[model samples]
Target: RQHNLRIKVARIFNTYGPRMHPNDGRVVSNFVVQALKGEAITLYGEGNQTRSFCYVDDLVEAFLRFMATGDEVTGPINLGNPGEFTIRELAEKVVALTGSKSKIEFRPLPQDDPRQRQPNIAKAREILGWEPTIALDYGLKKTIAYFDGLLRAGDGDLARLAAQ
Candidate 1:
């Protein structure tokens, strides 16, 4: 309540959808681009690390709802889908969706990699009455389609993105 500042901090999670840069280095983009390009799907660590994937549409809805809240609701709430999946699982899904011959490549785990990333959305559910509706497979299918178009049109730094 210091300074009575009006703030609604929503901790966004791994959001993926259309219009994402292929080489943004984000997990979703990395996998989708790699899969579509028939490149190795890089999975850091044993691919056991978990992450929650949220569709952009759901995140936007949460943002709108959070902003419309009363001033008293100055929440540092987590806004993301609670569904969690391992890195390997995500890569596999991308390959399957894209039907690419990309093999799963294991990379050295970054020292700062977290073992888990599923959000505790109880507060978001109770306060903002919001939760993600788009499932990972559905979202990935859409994302894969987008990246496929970009790659087919040669619209990005393919050499640079694949290097990541």
Candidate 2:
């Protein structure tokens, strides 16, 4: 306000969709790649920890909306789907969506891993009139199809890794 610079900040949450790196190590990528490869889906701890996932398209839309806002609307708003899913549920969905012959494998939780992480998108809704339109299943289907294509094409090292 003092500098009169119009600055808007957005705190984006976990996002997943097509074009994601196959081995970025994010949960969505990990699950999708492992499922596509018919490898065991690794779960940390009891797999009861929950997270909210936002489709990439919806997150991009929010970014555009936020950028187009008026100067008076400077915000550090949260931009993500408020819907949450447990890790186990996410792995199950990935397996089912990909139709992979993968099994679930549990391991000790990593240190500093949060038990639950969800966004409160109230500000984004009120300020930018934005919210995620893609459902989890629909988004996952699209993402799975993308990885399937990558595997089919044998494009990158990650693809090669996924095939094995």
Candidate 3:
């Protein structure tokens, strides 16, 4: 059975940055701390899986805009950056910024992971006039600094296996 109700769904994609689970192991945060600690960065499969990330700030703005719109604007909207990056590239950037001795390691990709995941935000651009301004490098640096602080203050290893 289905209720005859109207609603809008925002299909948000991968988001990253600080405040993320320290031992999340969800790639971005994982790679950041691993690089900071001079550890091996893990990549699944061919490391060609594409992903577009939006900072929390940008995501909040997008949500606000979506809420302000009228019923006519109700949509299956996509809120995320269009800038795509491969797993390998992301790992390299983290290593570069942190100046760590981490190396890249590849493993098997997970089941049901999309090979490509860039949001076609043309609709958002034309409708919401929203696009990500914070470059990945800048965002990653901020995240690295956040983790560095936690590590320096004796917060303990973020990726400790038992911490999960």
lDDT of 3 by residue, 23-141 (tens): 87677888988888888998999889888878777888888888778777877889899999998889899999999989998888989978998998887788788877888988898
In model 3, pairs of residues that clash are none
- Report clashes for each candidate as comma-separated counts: 0, 0, 0
Off by over 4 Å in 2: 1-5, 159-164
**Residue-by-residue lDDT tens digits, candidate 1, 19-131:** 77777789999988888777899899899999999999899999999999999887799988889899999988888888999999898999999999988999999998888
Give the winner by lDDT: 2
| Residue 2 alpha-carbon offset, candidate 2, angstroms | 8.8
Off by over 4 Å in 1: 1-5, 155-164
The list of candidate 3 runs beyond 4 A from truth reads: 1-8, 157-164
TM-scores of the models, in the given order? Answer: 0.90, 0.92, 0.85
Question: Which rank order by TM-score, best down to worst?
Answer: 2, 1, 3
Locate the minimum summed-lDDT window of 10 residues in model 2: 155-164
